[model samples]
Target: MMNDEQKTDKKQRLIRKGKKVQEPVNTQLVVNIFEGFTKDERDLTQAHMGAEYFRVMAWIKEEDEQETIGVRSFRGFHQFNERLVFPLDCSSYKYIYIELIKVHSRRDPATSKGTVVMGRAKIRLPPWTSRGKFTSKFNLVGLNSDRCVEIKGYLNLSMQLHRYLER
Candidate 1:
């Protein structure tokens, strides 16, 4: 025979078993986006001086959530010392994706939206089994005239995996 307390505990356990309880976020992925490089710069100093504006956007999903840096009018490189933190679940890890876009600055009237993807990069997550930090430059590639992908520039960033020391 079960007592009222035991019955209530059993019922609660059964309810919990029936539902999918997600694990608490015990880790975090920290990323510091530094700068973006451009391959060509002669035109920027000469013909296209101060005529180009670029923005670097980053995200870690196939979803709509994303973060973008403000438009920068520069000749050679784009600098952004932005940091983004993502809470990690124990289920799986996700990659950090980056995109460099050329934003229209009331000059170009070619595309309707006026944003073109100039370069792209994908950075893999740090190993979940280890706690460390990595800082390096990743190549950003784009399609050329014949549609063959080529290295456009580079994106410099640092990433670290931090796990909470649970008591």
Candidate 2:
């Protein structure tokens, strides 16, 4: 995470080869968001009680690359095999913050508000310093008043990091 001072200085550029360049991204982070599994204890507990539409929002910490997946109906496993590629300025980012968003509906009479962010999770970047892949399931976390993390359901995906290559 970058401090306030570093964030304020957007002019900071990295030297690639031997020339100074000003691009927001010096590295690229590839995220393949596949599915979401429920941790329900009872049958149809999480299966039936779902919304009309579902989406996902993810962002890198220091890189500040945020994106949202296309709207899709919630079928079994919250199925959405989306490949999201994010350009990162540096490798300062360590975690990919995930937000399961509930898209708003105007046609539904019961609807009252805009998109709502539901379960959330943090995918830790792999320990590898260079290009590599980390694939697994991560549980959603809830933060309380004490700033504690409580593991919730699961978000299945894969993350890969690659440094910019010269042409």
Candidate 3:
């Protein structure tokens, strides 16, 4: 027979022994899109007209989940100064897909009224960068019928990653 304090101590020790120690988790990714440019060129000449606005869609696709992290809309052709942040487990995601769509409001019912994809880009985490802070340039491309067309617009993006111990 043991006293109450001894019994408590014994239970604590057992619990501590049975508990599995967890290592510090440091896996976090942050992305920032500062600005983009649509140059004045032959391919982008048609895009300038009837272009009400442009939007960016960012998402991460995983084996069991597909998540959209950010969507930003701007009403200009020269610059899209935007900021987006995502708190996600980077290891589980397969790839990050980004699409820049040009929007127009057309009264004609025969045409697709609202949104048209102007550019698309995909990034795989490991090979891109490890420093977690950098700027990248991506060319805008569009699809015409069964062919891919390169537009004269480009997107400038800045990305950062932060890792801290999880509580």
Clashing pairs in 1: none
- Segments of candidate 1 deviating more than 4 angstroms: 1-25, 40-51, 71-73, 105-108, 165-167
**How many steric clashes does model 1 contain?**
0
Task: Name the weakest run of 10 consecutive residues (lDDT summed) in model 2.
Answer: 38-47
lDDT of 1 by residue, 46-128 (tens): 44535666777777765634565665746558887888777776637558788888777343457787776778988888887
How close to the true structure is residue 130 of candidate 2, measured as C-alpha lDDT? 59
Candidate 3 lDDT tens digits, 92-140? 6655677775555342224576665666777655432366577788776
Candidate with top TM-score is 1
- C-alpha positional error of residue 53 in candidate 2 after TM-score superposition, expressed in Å: 1.2
Q: What is the lDDT of candidate 3?
A: 0.58
Number of the candidate with higher lDDT, 1 or 2: 1
Ranking by lDDT: 1, 2, 3
Q: Which stretches of candidate 2 lie over 4 Å from their true place?
A: 1-25, 38-51, 62-65, 71-76, 105-112, 143-150
Compared with the true structure, all predictions reach lDDT values of 0.74, 0.65, 0.58
Reference-based lDDT, residue 14, model 2: 29
Whichever of 1 and 2 has more TM-score, that candidate is 1
Error of 1 at 118 (Å): 1.2
